[model samples]
Target: MEPSTGKKKTERNWGDKFLNIVEKTGNKLPHPATLFCIFAVAVLLLSAGLAALDVSAEHPDPDIDEKVKVVNLLSKEGIRDILTKAVDNFTGFAPLGVVLVAMLGVGVAERSGLISAFLKKIVMGAPDMLITAVVVFAGIMSSMASDAGYVVLVPLGAVIFLSKGRHPIAGLAAAFAGVSGGFSSNLIITMIDPMLGGFTQESAQMMDSAYTVTPAANLFFMMASTVLITVVGVLVTEKVVEPRLGSYTGSYKQDLDSLKPKENKSLKIALFALIAYVIVVALMTVPETAILRTDEGALLADHESPFIGAMIPLIALSFFIPGLAYGISVGDVKKDKTVVKYMEDTMSTMGGYIVLAFVAAQFVAYFEWSNIGFILAINGAEFLQAINLTGIPLILAFILVSGFINIFVGSASAKWAIMAPVFVPMLMNMGYSPEVAQLAYRIGDSTTNIISPLMPYFAIIVAFAQKYDKNIGIGTLISTMLPYSIAFMIAWMIMLSAWLLLGLPIGPEAPIYY
Candidate 1:
């Protein structure tokens, strides 16, 4: 039975008030790029102020006698250095080229209809009894192709549920939960992995100059999380969300279109091409003397290894080969020019990120060059150490901070650019690996996405939900997704705690402790 009307009303009032506060505060913040610019300027001023005071910290390494001190950035020499290094900083930013290269191939796959058709085939072909689980699983896996799930699978989810004589909103919630709430968990690598890993590596170099973090640093944990999120998402949807949503009583009822013969054939060709490409890559990495292996014959000995360094391009080719194959067979690629045009379209969408990257690069450069990041990290680590908060509790606290910050910052890369220089180095000083810190941040970031108003695609989700139930509002959507967000955070934390206690590697050649 439903809760008493008065009790429900009272609880909703409190939740709505808090969400309103968050929305208003988030709206008051500047655009991310602008925010970075402000931060850069603030860093310059802070550096000058701190330098005047001779603010410094003892190096964390006792063997090092020199203290890391803030450098004044408000002088003529500072301006000259800034002007000279600006372009180099933007160009040298680690995440830039890799994300672009990865997205190029992903764009071809998406534009060729390969990714879209694959999503449809999985969701539409599922048994009636297992449709919810399949939809959620497909949503989690869709990140392998980037943001296409938000555009393709979410609406299709509602349609799939409506056709099954169930509440369409329930299916929308389930799909959204899996896609956004489970965004950090994928069986395969996603663009965010490389992007965030690059940022983490840059931050780690503040303390450990030779340290490197690879895109696969958190792969094993993420793969397990895929199943964890899927199971938890399924349970929440069936037992909590769907039951609460009840049966479909809306005017909208649409049948999901089955995959056409030509698309199905194209998908088969694409899968074959993908499999063939994987085999080729495997051959190049599986043998001791293979071209992609390290000098010592290990395929993935370190980030400097040929296989590890080449992963971004390898991932690109994986998608490019299959996408080209499918597009040709499906007539999407009439000629070579068509493929180039598709790639061009993808680059055009990245104009904003490119702009953001420029300022973000400068901010990171300023923060590092001024020695503020190292000093703060040393002092922060010492403070945490003094409080005896060095292990699981510290990690949990960081996750909570990340999740709270995610509610206001829509872009994961942008947020991480600002946060990693602080948290990654701080955790490193505490004897934790950058991989562990990155994983914790990701867990916090992904779990809050479904309920966060700042997410770019949330409006689209709301519009889709409105098609099924006109009575639905922002409050209703948040209420629906809140369960998924909370459940995902709790379950993910439990898994992370267990993994830490067991001292298992989070990924290939990645240790939990530095």
Candidate 2:
């Protein structure tokens, strides 16, 4: 018994030590927006040095005769271009407009009280045995509604667990695991699908002009990942995370009342509204003569199709309609002014992200304008090929690189914008599809989000945990979520390996090979 106790203490100490290091290191990092500013400065300096040294790479396309060279941002013309195009960079940024449009609808859904009520409806009825899994599953699904899960489900997970006499932090870990760690996995397409897919498509087009990555690029794999993450979240919560938490000794009390009658009616109304909205969208895309389709009536075959272009807006409306229905049913939307106020309030919360996006947009523009990214991708491909690290090994290496970068930069889009320019083209040159590359990046980005201190929601989650146990700190949150991060990484890696071995289609038209 003494030996066993000592072994347990040693093992526990090791985990605590590692998690403490991660928490301290991550906390030392600058805000993600500031990190992008630093990266932009680095890119500028690197561009100048590389340009002076005449660093260049042969264009991959045989049709393109020009060598891609690093353009020095320190040049007079480059300075003029930078000053002139800053606003254009922010406005023309791929994810910005689309995400804003998508979130507008999501904001309506969230502010209408529909998202909260809907999440509660799913979680409140979960059986004691399956409640952890249910909360985690709801968290994963809530990404479809954007950051509403952080606002609704994380705290709700604690309340539900407390109501069931389970450790609330364990429940919060399960929720955070799903909400942040499993963020990249979803049964339905969300803002990220198209957002990352756009980056992939842009990068692939640098090599192959015809490559088209759609919102459904990683749909099948992400759907599978949703199940994998849910199972992992449940197992890690029940097995590793919860046991470590021991018992709930916190005196915080929660009223375990079921969803209100009005909320239930709101859900039904929201469902009907959602159904109606889906039918309207399907009508536009399903018919042969549909204006949203291509000349041959294909919806997604032509990336230029109206349906393809309209998809994100349609997604926003899907949430907006249901939320408006729920809001009206529940009297949250009493007038046009009330609806507008809710939308404003929701968008107001996005000010920080918008600010982050400004810096990220400029960084991406600088990287693109300097052509340093293209040169790096070309050189990186050659280096990898020379070392014979081409296929699965390369994929794993890229995932690790992405995960390492993710520790400091938490926004998926911001990290991907930086990574994709280098990696997507590099992978394409290595004979892998950009879609596959994006999927690998997503795996790395998602798995590490739970443990990253820079994750915008990390502090928010720590606050949530502290509500139950005032002693909860950053390290406590990190230690609790560490299990989920590790479990997710291993399980997700296995799935990716199996996926490659099986040569499965990751999405509708997403091929694994270039």
Candidate 3:
């Protein structure tokens, strides 16, 4: 099924063989939930063995100046701790609550058909000159709304492309590339900034007690990346991915019905509600004495602000109120019971994720408690420090390592918690700032997300793809997305290299040097 791309058979065949091997090896693994369970067990055994070997690292943070040793899960105290915290682990998993809360509002928009209508209107009304770029841009911007892009934009990409007689998978690829692959890139500050920045700050404090890493440390770089990624996404989609995908012959076709009079009226109501909601939010967030503003007068800009904590619930309300307005206008919602039903339906779809989350949470928690990740990171840092690699080469090497690690461990904050304590101090000693190190790690983390099987959303993208072609598998999805990954890695690294070479500030008051 390989299209004649004018490449040599040897080159094409070699690529195909490698992808086949990857697919087969990945398929050989058990289900993701089961795999996480195995990972949890492996951490247990590894921790015990390493503990017996007397492996440990001196704590980086001065407050915890003692040696950090591995806690063997096989021990009596360890087992008891694990058993006691199992429920807490599952409940406290970061993504679980974020996803659930966001979906509650999104569920309303989706079920009320507001999201569908909005997406359809955007796609259908947009000129062909801007459709692909808009989709990619929209996906990139969705970071503010959390994972709503994945659920709403991804499938909509396919539907929009199909409506326009383009290959749907290509559209899916573009959206996935923008959403997951460009995760670290956005025009506005996102939850990721504070999430990873907290880890970076914790690590930096080990070396410099007074060091601080703000959430906006990488804002400038990330903002630039947003534009870079959108352009790259558009180019890859139009030039490479679409040509490779050829024409759409899929069984699934979008029902691109034009809006009826009542639906149009409903859409008008939704628009008015959305505009009014935005105005109210602006009023609350803009002024110095605004209710939603922090005591310092920043609204959702500071990590410690109540606005940050309130964003999820606010997101839910944003969608919910507008969706409710639209639904009521269209007669889709007669009473509160219908809204309750929509939320229930959304919650019901979360069963698989809940099981996966239970196991993943255990694995993450066990890994942290065991301290294997910490020890390895420390040892790795020591080795690199001994070799004394410096400058952009060092940054590039770190990005590559981070990317490789991302394939196995999917959570950004989890991996950073393990890695930052080691790399941050080590790099600071080498005269590079923690913000630079964190930015490098983020480049690595985001570039490979599209191709990594372990990413939390990877399976969902596969399922989304299968809606178009039932034969779509893990390998197929990976192969399809590999180009985006490769292109992003190359392009993003180049961009970062340029920034580093010029010694540009990564963000506001975020210098490259210590």
Candidate 4:
């Protein structure tokens, strides 16, 4: 389903030839849900075979001095375990609840026309000189709201660019690149920061009991990367992607009259509500005696802080209050029942994701139970250690490996859980800090996300693209995004190399050396 951009097939170059192969091969695969089902079954069979051969690894943790064996999921006991745990697996799937809850609030905003109005503000009100950077930076910063970026910004970016008489696909590419490719680069601390930091801490303590990885471990590096990604996004969009895309011929047009006086009033109400909400949140967390602070009088940045755990609900309320305000002002939500209806409608759209989540939950559970990821990580780390590689070259090589593995495993935390226990200690032994190792892993994990089929948001982005160009397919999206992916990897690698040479600290206490 390659898009017919009217370019002759004869003009296709080597990169095009390569991406066509990638897309076609990817398209030949089953749907993500079915693929996860296959992976679950594969994990079961592989576990049984490995258990038969008694394959295992020596657990890396000094406290847990035991060999880790692959658990056989084919046995009667294993079957019973699977049957009983299936429901819990789906319910406990990390992204499932977060996405569903967030969408509930976003649904209200969208239905009440608040979202559209806000997007128009960005599109129409932003200075033309700063629009590209603003869009890219906003996309990067959207990590704070969890998956909201994928749900909102990607589509908005296309709409914004289309309104400006540019290729909408390029806008989509730029936004997707920033949202996913720059996922690890944010000026603010996000849920993933403490989440991955916890993994790094656990792995680090396996080697040194007192070692800890704070939420801010990669803060400085990621802050710098925010700017780097923005610059790269602009460069890739303007210099390569847009020029190749040429003019958009799609029928989608901006509704110039959509923002009525009533809508504008609603928008104003929403904006005021949002400002008030921010003020309240700041007061609750910014002061020494802040209610949102930890028992130790610490702010939201602590690993054990409730604030991070409360992000989903906070995000939901943040959207909900403003959305509710707008809805009331616009008279679209006359009653509480209308808000519930909007929420229901949003859930209705998640049917595909629910199915995918179930299967993916099973796959992830089976992979964990079978101990496959751990064994792979342990053995992979040992192989790298045996080679005795050191310095920036080793870190660069590790980044490439992490990026390659990310194509198959979608979750950043999941991959880091497997890799951290292995690489953190391995790098620590080489006199590199856990923070440095985590930073490198983050770069690899994020840069490859735009190109990975396993990423949960990939299909959603494709659907958004299809809204404009019906002929667009996985191939078209991948081809359009490949440049950004390549550009991010190169730019990030160079930045990391320079940072290392300069002996820069990544965060408050995060140094490059162990």
Higher TM-score: candidate 3 or 4?
A: 4
Instruction: Give all candidates' CA lDDT scores.
Output: 0.77, 0.75, 0.80, 0.81
**Alpha carbon lDDT of residue 251, candidate 2?**
63
lDDT of 4 by residue, 1-514 (tens): 4333443222246765665666566656666667678878999999999999999998766567889898999989899989999999999987678678878887888787787788776676566436777778878998876677887678778878877777888788888888985568998777688788989999999889999888899999989999899999988888777766677766677654457788888899999999999899888878888787887776655436766667777778888999999999988888889999999998997886788778878887887889877777667667767777899988988988888778767778878887888899888988899999999999998888888755767766766786777666666777778888898999999999999999999998999999
The candidate scoring highest on lDDT is 4
The digit string of per-residue lDDT tens for model 3 on 1-514 reads 3211222112235555565565556656776678778889999999899899988887655567689799899999999989999999989976678677877888899899887677667677676548889778888988776666776678768777877767777888888889975568988888678778889998898888899988899999999999999999898888766765666765666666787788888999998998998898878877898887777786655446766677777778888989999999999999999999999998997776678778878888898788776666556556666776788888888888788777766778777877788788878888999999999999998888889765766656765676677556666677778878888999999999999889999999899999
Per-residue lDDT, model 1, residue 498, is: 99
lDDT string, candidate 1, 1-514, tens digits? 2211121211234554554454345545565567678879999999999999999987654445888889988888889889999999999866567657877987898789777676577655566548988889989987764565675568768767776767778888888988885568988777578778888998899889999998899999999999999999999888777765555656675544678999999999999999999899889989899999877896644356777678778878887899999999999899899999989998886676677677877887887788876565456445544665768899987777678767755567766766677678878888899999999989988999888754656655765676665545556677778888988999999999999999999999899998
* Candidate 1 regions with alpha-carbon error over 4 angstroms: 1-13, 125-256, 388-514
lDDT of 2 by residue, 116-189 (tens): 67657765656755998888998899876455566556876876787676777777888888887546789888
CA lDDT, candidate 2, residue 72: 94
C-alpha displacement of 477 in model 1, angstroms?
14
Candidate number with greatest TM-score: 4
Candidate 2: deviation at residue 236, Å?
Answer: 4.7
Instruction: Answer with 1 or 3, whichever has the higher lDDT.
Output: 3
Higher-scoring candidate on lDDT, 1 or 4: 4
Model 2: residue 404 alpha-carbon error in angstroms: 6.9
| Residue 132 in model 3: lDDT | 88
Candidate 2 has its poorest 10 consecutive residues by lDDT at 1-10
Worst 10 residues of 4 by lDDT: 2-11
TM-score of each: 0.64, 0.68, 0.84, 0.87
> What C-alpha lDDT does candidate 3 achieve relative to the native structure?
0.80
